[model samples]
Target: MSEPLVKEYSNGEVTIVWKPDLCIHSGICLRGLPKVFNLKQRPWVQPEKANSDQIVALVRECPSKALSVKGVRFKEKDNSDVKVTLIPGGPILIKGGATVTERNHKQVHRETVAFCRCKRSRKFPYCDGTHAQPKED
Candidate 1:
């Protein structure tokens, strides 16, 4: 079988593992804790950003299972195929081949997909460039 695409990190407080394949790039990690999850840097996970408790809580909030924590004895896998893009004021753009199912009985076999996070897309689940609108702040 192929190798897993996950990475692990720890700072004596706790150990965190990241699975890029399952990541939806919600920006929760970076937004919640920029000190630890810096996308601008390579390897992108700084165990020192926050304590294990805080990190665990934030990781759990991820809509996707991109972030996970467990005992220190677990091993991290390699994540080379996972591509995470940070869209400005928009949902994350994931690039890969996966099965997507909708409530309208439509199944799309696509290589790329963009999810909306700004919550202003007229296309519902898909992004329709609604994030370009100004927010009330």
Candidate 2:
């Protein structure tokens, strides 16, 4: 197998390297920091867009092992049954063959679910343009 493309960014304190081939394109990086991880750009992932702590947090959220902390060793989980995605400013999207039981409904389906995090969503349990809304100072 060929080596994956790795991009590195640093702000003197620490550096972050991203492996695109391993990435699932969950959009977590871009959503977390558009100024850095602009998908529309030729070379995405600008470390200067955010601080080291913020970048590390977003990278750790990646479901896929695409993003990793530079020089840090970690173990890979067996993710054979679950599908994970890191959406920008949105909930981590998860889908695939799974079972979800509700109050009166026990459904087994292949569907995508978006979990909310911004907390300003009109659509609870999911994101609905809430992240785009301007925040009040």
Candidate 3:
């Protein structure tokens, strides 16, 4: 297996782990906390801008589960109620946690996941933010 491309940003108390490959670029992080998740910034993520608790709370809302804190696992509940959100031109986000079975027969647990609807994703079933890119004629 290939190593995933990941970046880490720390603010002493908490460290944010970013998995770009897993990100659907829904902009939830950027929109929710621009002070820390500015795209125009050099490193992109500046965890120092917000308190650790605030960052953690926002990261937990990431539908793609791309943004997470080190040593922290997503808290799961027994609620079977799931909610799906369709992002205008992006991936379909499914929240409320579920067990996703991959084509390889691997069962992965996730609090949220993004599925590609545009069919342009190189990641196949999963959205990798390809729908947001310009189409080539």
Candidate 4:
């Protein structure tokens, strides 16, 4: 019910927009371009480290639509297939434009999303990186 958190990182030609609230921490960005999406670093995103084209390509791979480039339009994924993947210790990743029904009976469609399986996320159905944190007894 509040505004989603958005952060921007620019390399002049390309400006990467990040919506943390929509992020599933799928690691696609990190895995594709570690130099630009390093989690160990402060700010976490360093668009300046990579070329604009490279950055844009990786941002497009984001399943949750959490990462985007300013002034750029991403092609929608084909909705013909829906697949679900269960991570070993993380969230459940769903792809291919799946429709989700919330507790309030609101249905939402996502091209790619990660649902919380650890049952520790404050964000309820969505994974907010809480599963990666050390647990306390």
What overall lDDT goes with each candidate model? 0.76, 0.72, 0.91, 0.89
| Candidate 4, number of clashes | 0
Tell how far residue 88 is off in model 3, in angstroms. 21
lDDT of 4 by residue, 1-137 (tens): 88878999988788999999899977878878999999899889999999988998888889899999999998786755888899999999998877776776578988999999999999978999999999989
Candidate 2 residue spans exceeding 4 A from truth? 73-137
In order of listing, the candidates' clash counts read: 0, 1, 0, 0
Give the least accurate 10-residue stretch of model 3, judged by summed lDDT. Answer: 74-83
Give lDDT: candidate 2, residue 11: 67
Candidate 1: worst 10 consecutive residues by lDDT? Answer: 71-80
lDDT score for residue 37 of model 1: 92
Show model 1 residue runs off by greater than 4 Å.
72-137
Report the lDDT tens digits of candidate 2 across residue range 1-137: 87768877776766778777888876767766788679787666677768887877777777786887787665664667678888886677787654444334555454766667888878765667677778878
**Deviating ranges (above 4 Å) for candidate 4:** 79-137
Give lDDT: candidate 4, residue 78: 70
As for candidate 2, its clashing pairs are 31-88
Ranking by lDDT: 3, 4, 1, 2
RMSD of 2: 13.7
The CA lDDT at 113 in model 4 is 92
Looking at candidate 2, the ten consecutive residues that score lowest on lDDT are 97-106
Against the hidden reference, what TM-scores do the models get? 0.51, 0.50, 0.59, 0.58
